[model samples]
Target: MKPTETDSTAVDWRGDSASSPDVTRRERLKETYEARVRTPALVAWADWRTRFGLLIIGGYVLMALVAVLGLWREPSTSQAPRLLGPFTDMSYPLGTTQSGVDLMALVIHSTPTILILITAGAVWATLIAVIIGTVAGYKGGSVDRGLMSFSDLVMAIPGLPLVIILAVTLNPENPVVLGVIINISYWAGLGRSLRSQVLTIRENNYVEASRTMGISTPRIILKDIIPNLMPYITVNFVFAARYVMFASVGLYFLGVLPYSTQNWGVTLNFAYSNGALFSWQAAHWLLAPMIAIMGLSLGLILLGQGLDRVFNPRVRTRMAGESKSTVADDDDDTVTEVF
Candidate 1:
């Protein structure tokens, strides 16, 4: 009992760390899960671009929620006056359109629609990537050849053209279908990326050990292989979302589908087509959707940048750990600071 206690005490002494609540691994993990795993934040408060990126996105999302709850009363076309410039009227702050639709409410209301499209698109793309990539990469030979051939075929088609063709054919109303169409076009690239990563991971010593220990292939994939690729997968998912956002906007701008005030693309198209740009009185109507889209894009892009740091263990270490100093000749200063 004495020897056992001594051994335990030695282990604890060796591993014990002086940690504050804010800097502890547990706190960091919680923040990571909340920001990266849940939605997204940024790398550092010092980085103004990333900070504003998250702030802009979060602010719009809050506004959208307010709109959804009916707390933001949109001035109806039938009762309210039209073309009121921003701050001129308290009833419709930010003004109303030529048709008397409250510009603030229209932009705010469209927030959920945009977020839903990107999120649904990301999930669909990631799911397809995991399933096909894991199976194809892990179970190679004929399976790999078949899957790669299919991926190649899909990649060969012009993505925007294919999406336009499909949109024209199906005539979808639900915004979810736009996300699905993007998945069909974009998942192949993600699957290919994931497949390569899985192949590299499958050859690792830990994975090999699992394979030799009578562990099933599915278990090895789910418990061992996939976990290693999640960071890579997450980064790619953000990229996929970026693609979906811009593509959907372009599609809607072209009038490929029915217009909804809930869609920023439609809002932009309506504003531009109806001479809002020429009418300086109602120019905010044109710029509102543009601002909304830019904010969303910038947030996702910067969040992805921040996530690149988080997902990288070395980057995470350099950011959170302060134990090392740089070598004079190191190419990456941040990387070199870790001893």
Candidate 2:
């Protein structure tokens, strides 16, 4: 008796057979699953630069957590003699400001605000850029022209001056609101760049295939386009965060932003206002915040660089190949020992 076309037994069950179509299909599915399941953060950890960046960022987070839990001296409370130089007292490691507040506590407490500022700003900018850019590029025609034109208009405005004006006008006290205000001019440039990238991405065969298959535009953009654009998006997010950090700090240092909260910038402002820059005894006050800013910025920049490998298919494939080869070698050694 001949097997029918729908016969269950007619289908090959041997997925291990090299020549079997089931094997090919299974392998493809496995690859797809692995690709989707692997997160960029975990993939980025293989790079030494990412590890170092994480260490720096993690230290700041730990400090912030410690402050939040009240594990250390309050940043506002006087803990030692005013203007006591660092190393003068074992208890006050980073010394005390002119107000007798512990400099180390100030730095630690400032972490949460700075982190929140950067995070909020980056998220806002990146979200706007991705949405606008993706839509403008994918839609084309009048939609593209309109979006691009608006973006160009925004790009024409001077970023810093506009931010300063907004800061003065809004008088935002909330760090999140302050972050959004500072990044007002940031999304336009990034959006334009992302639109250009999207133009190229939308022309790819897979995207075209999706379009031909009558897939919804939103689905195509979400599934096909965004995944491919992850590397650019990740890098831009870091860039946006860095810009927010610097801009917010500058605004605070200049006293344009309301001093409603503890901040690294506010610390710097107070330090310089109190003559920390000119006096040797007060130098620690100025230098501590400066070092913190630089360290945090360095970590973000390094993490961005390392993250390129996490999302770039070619780089990720190469890394995976190397890992597999190493595993294969170890397996051979283990098998030989057993034999």
lDDT (Cα, tens digit) per residue for candidate 1, span 1-339: 356988988877766644445368788897667545433222344356557667877887898788779787653432457777877888777777778888778777777777888888888988888888998999899999999899889889998788888888888767788788866768898889889988888898988999899899899999888877867886788888988888888778888865445478887887888898898887888887788788788888776665555556555456443312333335366566774
Give lDDT per model, in order.
0.76, 0.87
User: Model 1 segments beyond 4 Å from truth?
Assistant: 1-54, 75-81, 259-262, 315-339
Best by TM-score: 2
Per-residue lDDT, model 2, residue 187, is: 95
lDDT: worst 10-residue window of model 2:
9-18
Q: Please give the lDDT score at residue 239 for candidate 2.
A: 93
* Model 2 misplaced stretches (Cα beyond 4 Å): 1-33, 36-43, 326-339
> Local error of candidate 2 at 137, Å?
1.3
Cα TM-score per model: 0.75, 0.85
Write model 2 residue lDDT over 1-339, tens digit each, in one string.
977766644454432354677778889997776565544444788789899988988998999899899898887776579998888997888889998989888888888889998999999999999999999999999999999999989999998899888888888878899889889879998888888999999999999999999999999999999888898999999999999999889888988888766688889999999999999989999998999999999999888888878888887787677766876999999999999
CA shift of 306, model 2, Å:
1.0
| Overall local distance difference test of candidate 2 | 0.87
